[model samples]
Target: MKLKKIFLITVAVLSVFYTIGCWDMVDIDKRFFVGNIGVDRAEDGEQMLVTFTFPIVRKIAGGQGGGQGGGGGSTIVVISTVTDSIHAAARQAAMRLSRRLFFEHTRVILIGEELARDGIEEVVNFLERNTEINRRGRVIVVRGKAKDALTIKNEIEVLLALYIANIFENRDICARFIETDVDEFMKQVHSMNGNVLLPRLTPGKTDVKIGGAAVIKKYKLVGWLEENETLGANFVLGEISGADIMIDIPGYKYPVVFTVTHNKAAMELLEAGDYPKFRVKLEVKGEIVETPEQIQLAPEMLKIIEKMLEDRINHMVLASIRKLQEEYQVDLLGFGEYLSKYKPDVWEEYKKDWENIFPDAEINVETKVKIRGIGASK
Candidate 1:
């Protein structure tokens, strides 16, 4: 009887902890899930403007009958507030919102060109410190206002953030745009020099186009690169997985398309001294994707196609390098990184004045292409 009384007391004591209830519990219906965040400079020119986009769960959720005709508005709500900091802006936005703002589902982060040109230190810090945000969240610089990109009416994906995020899945297929997420951007920012390229977003009449790339030097946007230049940059970076080259056949009155099947790049530091000389060799293998009806799939014809592809690839890659060497005077081609790893002595000697020295560096490019096969033919 004495032992039974002690056992009953132990069970009664453990029940109290579970019965206390959750101190941090909030009702699910009282929270909003943020899908995208946009940062821009305020018109007043003294404060930062932050926009938060969240979907109306009931309207977006499948099997729910909600639309403009049903006395409802757009499926997403965008709210903007001007403040000195991101946290402050969030707090200000919460004032008029009936539900608490949550950011665990944020997929895209858009920065206005104006704000990107200024600098993204504070924005980077906020992303780093926010535990709720995923590191895979994409980062883009809008050509104009980031808020406008967030406000776009996307028919493909109900949420604009998801639509923008889905575009990155084609990185391998195009290679014309760099896939930069929060983690990748941060890694580049912490490199030997904070020089990187981020994809540019432009809003159109009926859709948003994601192409090109914004050149960032020392964490500030300096300029932009066109789609061809971006593709050339990708070639030098060895980031090209799949892309096409058009070859104009002589006397065929039509162009033949070559789809890249394999690619490799090699860099040789021929002479390491004041104003070093480097040679880049790019090798590519492709298959004829499109050809004229009368064209014969002969070895000689294939050889001609290969030669043409070589010249075109060489021109494309060299143009990007020259632009970096002459116009931007920035090194996004990993020349500095190559020297730092392979020849630390040279990097140490020129690291201080690399900005000035890179332009003077002699670079030579050589391209070789092989035609592997002709589609549905020899």
Candidate 2:
């Protein structure tokens, strides 16, 4: 009886420690879930302006049954702070915020064009070092200001971060923008020596537009690749899953629309001379979505359409290549990477002066398009 009593007392004492719950755990209502982060160069030109957007959980929960605008006033709150570093900015914003700012739920990081042009070394460093940030969150360059993009009155989605991140899902149907996450951005920037393409976000009155691409060379924003040019670059990068090409026929009021379903590209080294000669061959398969009225879908007609698509694709790819080579004098198409991986022997000789040689290098493009269907119309 004495031993049994002693054992029961010991068991009761140990259970108290486990039943107290977590000592550092904060209640859900007290924590603010950050949705997006925007970084821009301050007006003073010496500091950074960081903006954070987070949703009000109470408002979101209360407005559940109601429509999009039902959530009290605004479901999210935006806060901005000017500081020398991102971390410092966050700490400074804490002075004004009621709840602690949390970043684990962050969905997107937007960098302003001005800051991007100056250089993204600080931004990159913060992203890499911050353990609370989501690795899969998108990293984008805003056309004008990062704060403007974040402050848009987006009604399509409850949270702006989700609205922006979800846009990448359309990449399968439209290959106009570059989709890169923080993890992939870091890897590419490190591997390519700070030469990478990031998606561009343009703000509007009601909503925002995500298209085109921001060209970054040496971690600095050099220029932008337009929608079509971005599509061409996607082809060379073998990142094209779908695209629409319009072809004009001899006699037609409307042009024929080709929708790409499959795409593959190969790079071949023709010569390793003073300026190396290269050829890019692309094999594409798609279907005709729209055709001119009364147009025949005969076998000969299909061949003609295929030839037109091939020529169109070739032109687009070559135009993008030329722009990068001649105008930008930068290789963002992984040409150097391809050479280093497959043709290491040649890469050794050209890698030293590859920057100067690449602009003058001769590059040819060949495209073959196959039409799988001509839609339901005869």
Candidate 3:
């Protein structure tokens, strides 16, 4: 009987402890789920304009006579505040909001071009230090003001964040833009010393276009990489999953459309002399999706088509490299990283002055394409 009495007392004590833990817990209904974050440079140039977009819980739940296409307003709400820092902005916004702003569901982070041009160090710091930020969330550089992008009324997806995040799923089909999540962005910034590429978002009337890429060097936005240039860069990076190439044949009235099935890239350091000589070899395999007219699928004709595809790919890859070397004078390619891993000895020699040496380096590109199929037509 005495042992049973002691056990009961211990159980009661543990129950009391568990109950105390819930004392500070806020109810789910009292919190707001932040869907996206936007950062822009304030007009004064001394502070940051931070915007937060979140779904209205009542409207989403259809509690306040609101439906999917209700006439009241958008299902989501957007609030902004100008403060010295992102954290401060959040706190300042809380003064006007009734519920706490929660970021565990944030799906996108948009940085305005104006602020990106000035620098993104502050944004990076906030992403790293904030424990609530989602690491899998995508980071994009908006073409204009982030505020404008965030305010867009997207009707496709229930939430604007979901709409934007889902666009990245099309990367495999279209390689026109660069995709980088918060975690990958952080890793590249550290590994590449603040040289990275992020997707560009262009706001439209009630919609947004995600294409091309924003070039970031030393944590500052330098310029943009066009759709074709981004596609070429993806080839060198071995990131091409699917791309269509149009080759105009002499006889055919229309161009032949080829779809890439597989691609592989190899880099070689032929000579590490005054101007390092490097060669990039690309092996590509694809199929002809469209043909102007039905022609004999002869072995010789296939060979000719293969050569045309090879030339087109070579031109694209080389043009992208040349622009980066001559126009940007920055190496977004993994040449430096490759040397560090494959030829550490050579990297040690050029690591100190690689920025200046890379521009003058001689790079040769070679591409070989094979036609795997001629589509349904004979």
Number of the top lDDT candidate: 2
TM-score of each: 0.91, 0.93, 0.93
What's the CA error at residue 352 for candidate 1, in Å?
1.2
Model 2 Cα lDDT, one tens digit per residue, 1-378: 999999999998878756866565677788888989999999999789999999987777777856554836888899999999999988999999888888888999999999999999999999999999999999999999999998888788888789989999999999999989999999999998899999999999878888999999999999999999999999998887888989998878899999998999999999989988999999899999999887878989999989989899999989999989987888899889889999999999999888899999999999988999888876
**Worst 10 contiguous positions by lDDT, candidate 3:** 63-72
Error of 1 at 241 (Å): 1.3
Clashes of 2: 0
Over 4 Å off in model 3, which ranges? 1-24, 63-69, 294-296
Report clash pairs, candidate 2.
none
Q: What digit string (tens of lDDT, one per residue) describes model 3 on residues 92-117?
A: 99999999999888999999999999
Error at 52, model 3, angstroms: 1.0
lDDT value, residue 128 of candidate 2: 98
Tell how far residue 264 is off in model 1, in angstroms. Answer: 2.5
Cα distance off (Å), candidate 2, residue 291: 0.5
Candidates sorted by lDDT, descending order? 2, 3, 1
